[model samples]
Target: MQAQTMQAQTMQHKRCMATVNKSRSMMRTYLSDEGVPLSYSRKRRIAMNLLKEYIREKYSSNEEIQEKLLETLSVYFNQVDNILQKTESPIEKTMAIELLNLIKSDSELGEIGFVDLEPQKTIKLNNRNKYYVADFLITWKPTVSVNGVERKLIVECDGHDFHEKTKEQVKKGKLRDRKLFLEGYTVFHFTGSEIYEDVSGCAIEVLEMIRSWHLSWVHG
Candidate 1:
């Protein structure tokens, strides 16, 4: 996709128009850029009115009201993009790259590096065609044992799924985690808050788990 089109699609998927407008307003305040105080509630009401106008315009085939809503959305999203770009932190970028590289390496994890361990990395665990994306996957080449038998080192990653919808959804997530565990996979889970608050600590915990697995395989 063209860069602008891809960006638009990403924004559409990541945020609703209402959220865009609200965040844009908050960002403007943070930046102290020149802008009037925009009330989220009022803006939402205006959007509802616009929707009404849209229906009327559609029945009359006027298209003007529909064009207006599109224009408003475009401007709102642009503001949100600018605000986010300005406020974006380098730590998030660095951490993402660091975490990704840590996962890719074959070195034993320390208190610093963790890998995504979801079996989808070694086998198709999730029927999603896409492998399960996790924080770490630890695996060892099949090794010969003292009895001349072979073994496969296990891989597992820590997963944190925020924004689980309802109670049922949370229950389903637990079931899925249980199923993954039953399939000879180890699963570690954290919340987004934990990641943000104590990233280093979380990384350390993951590394310890991976190292333990490695040591057991070598000594077993």
Candidate 2:
């Protein structure tokens, strides 16, 4: 089994290399003959000739960049898994989620686990191509009845900016929350000071949302 796994990995690496090469070749072709600044009078004659020459000389069929990107991705994924296992903080975990599923791992080795349906994630919207990356996510387990069936929350660790530019930041945050609502996620933002001042209160609010979700699920 170990031997077969190694063989499969090797085959995958080779296929990745081939794909990298093909993409690199195509990019070079596009970049090389795309365009050039030209003199007014000699523009017509030189443009096509220069473009052809540029394409021929500058375009090299190489997989160097592709190979580098693949290598970097592999390294990042490995590091991300390492960090996830090592850290206990909610903030770190949130950052990892923000990075998304670009990280790849071998499932057979137990590198991945099932994630239960929890708070919404930083989902991309094709229309705006934007998503929220909150500091923490919570869910309502069926047993704990509170806000509704499921509720999503966004917690922002507000800094000095939140106080200094209070009005502006609040406006922007509300706008962001509005966008999140439109995207089907409930957002609850809190400042760092608020958390520090009323840690228990913050905890209660989170629990209340969970219970609310649970109760909704029960009633419906």
Name the best candidate (by TM-score): 2
Error of 1 at 184 (Å): 1.6
Q: Which ten residues in a row are the worst by lDDT in model 2?
A: 106-115
lDDT of each residue in 172-209, candidate 2, tens digit only: 77787788778666666655556445544554565456
lDDT of 2: 0.45
Tens-place lDDT per residue, model 1, 131-178, is 343333444332332352222223222234323567896797677667
Flag regions of model 1 displaced more than 4 Å. Answer: 1-95, 101-123, 126-162
Clashing pairs in 2: 145-211, 146-211, 146-212, 146-213, 147-211, 147-212, 147-213, 148-212, 148-213
The TM-score measured for candidate 2 stands at 0.39
Best by lDDT: 2
Error of 1 at 55 (Å): 61
Q: What is the TM-score of each candidate against the true structure?
A: 0.38, 0.39
Error of 1 at 118 (Å): 9.1
